[model samples]
Target: MELDYVVGQTLAWLRALGIEKDTFVFFTSDNGAARVSDVPVPGGGSNGPFLCGKETTFEGGMREPAVTWWPEHIPAGTVSQQLGTVMDLFSTSLSVAGFSVPDDRLIDGLDLSPVLHNNTLINRPIFYYRGNGIMAVRVGLYKAHYWTWSNSWEEFNQGINFCPGQEVAGVTTHTQQEHTMQPLIFHLGWGPWEKYPISAVTTEYQDALSRITAVVEKHKKGLVPGVPQLNMCDMTWLS
Candidate 1:
């Protein structure tokens, strides 16, 4: 209800400015909810059926729910299930504003015009990063988690801290562990509540993993070795 009120206020402001039809509005969050506002998992917030919470590679951590609006451009009540990431916002907004992205820098985003306008399904692979390292990759509807950790406190609660009528039992949570040599694959489209790994039986799993690996490798090769442009120009850094 609060979010709806905020959305209404935003549309009212746009309408008052007489640019409601010309402007594009996008609503999304950087990551999933936190279990506890200050601490890690099994604390306060909820991600519904998504496994784990923030600070992890699970869909519950990175796969956010979003909404976009563009008056006549984006059809009214059109719901597209296209796969995308927060990184795509840059390129998509640039395209919407009729601006060309600089060619000198390596951009990790793609223009999502086709997907938004025509409801096209693009096979865009998304890489999940935790700090400086990549922990997982998603190609289409399949995700390959190269590294995993017990992302919440509830995982290790063992029914001691669990509230009545909770979906998961206390014994469900587990302690953190190290990464394994083999990756675990999941069909995200089937829902995150089902923690079944499909890679062992599905032939398409290997193909998807291969394609995602190639994408990651390509992006790595394009990286420029240096401090960020913003950091380099800081007066503090020069001294």
Candidate 2:
């Protein structure tokens, strides 16, 4: 695959430059793989065992495949299930470079050096946003879905149509509608295929929900009003 070739070259280049040990290379996709129905068959990408695929706030959409490379910094053959986001790169890179993040601004990213260096656990809740609105949040092993949508274009019925016994090929129709309702809770530790509601069954659900709700409230309090800017000068090439 092209991705494989590119990554191989990247590592090779880093090794040649003698900076592979010092450089931090994080390889990951922006979202999960495309569903089988969305792409052409014979080589259609799978979202693995996750519920849905790209373009939705499901675990499949938010949980992406990632690989971090830092030869001497990050331990080899070590895998961390730590919760992290792309936003953390800003602060993490700065920290690794020995620079301080600005104290005047709200930084949603926590320093991931500890997690990478010592395998520390990060219990922060990751708020999943679809555009300007918050769709869901995941803290620890629990995830709360406040909004719902099917991964593929076929919508809610796609699951039934694409299952093992009920497999239907080349079905593309927009029959699902966006939905808003009470939050649906899931414990990801239970496994990717377990989507059953366990809020009533587990006492930790309400406590975790309350903590996540507070996180949202604290985030709201940190919001700063935006000020529009305009360019007043024109630039010309200098002799």
Candidate 3:
């Protein structure tokens, strides 16, 4: 574990630098363990608790691990599940280094120095997106998975053969039904591995045709008028 190893080495380095045990060491990752195969496991990497491989914007693929350490100055033997992002690390390290955000540069990350020093929670608003799709947004305990579009073209964007229940690009776009599918939403607290059509049990599912029609009606001039849009691909977990 990089986190564990870094914790040990930081202590050694602090002593070498004569910084004393009061020196702090911060640790984190770009994202949750969504590594395709960075771990040395026989099969896939250890994104344990999350589902599928990375590149498909999901909880397992996005949420990363974050940590901070200081032998004497920071609280010992404590862990907190604070929801933060990679951008937070820049501001955090800057603060720990006694630096300030530049007046001209724009920043989208939160400063997590308080959490590092006092164990305060910095978990707050967050959003996930893939392409133009606003995949999910987090608000406290409620996580809304919005399927803004519908399954169309049956086939992926290739426009030759239809999707055949295989992972295309990264979106999964296949179902048992012959023609129709539905948008799905899941409560993220449950891990979201078993996402299915909104009405997976029922014969009726939302028609990609209808969804397309609705979009065209809402924005008539911009549905790529007069051209067939059959190559539309829908985003999902299983292809």
**Each model's total of backbone clashes:** 5, 0, 8
- Candidate 3 lDDT over residue span 1-239, tens digit each: 98569777867777898885656566656554433332333233445555444454455566666556666666777787677777777787788879996767556677888877788886565656566445555544334444322233543243322112223332344332222133343345553542432343543323433443354344333323233444355434335
TM-score of each: 0.78, 0.78, 0.57
Q: lDDT per residue, candidate 1, 1-239, as tens digits?
A: 99889999999999999999899899999887765333444365677877766655676667788899889899888888787888899999998888987789878788998877898878787888776677778777778776665444564354333221223422123443343355677777885642777655567667766776787688678766665556766789889
Ranking by lDDT: 1, 2, 3
What TM-score does structure 1 among the candidates reach?
A: 0.78
lDDT of 2: 0.67
What's model 1's lDDT at 24? Answer: 84
lDDT for residue 92 in candidate 3, whole number 0-100: 76
TM-score for predicted model 3 compared with the true structure: 0.57
Q: Which scores better on TM-score, 1 or 3? A: 1
Question: How much is 30 displaced in model 1, in angstroms?
Answer: 0.7
Full-model lDDT for every candidate: 0.70, 0.67, 0.51
Residue 100 lDDT (model 3): 95
Model 3 segments beyond 4 Å from truth? 1-7, 20-23, 32-42, 131-133, 147-185, 190-239
Question: In model 3, what is the error at residue 188, expressed in angstroms?
Answer: 3.4
Candidate 2 residue lDDT tens string, 155-234: 43554322222122211113333323446667788865435755544677677667777777887687775643533442
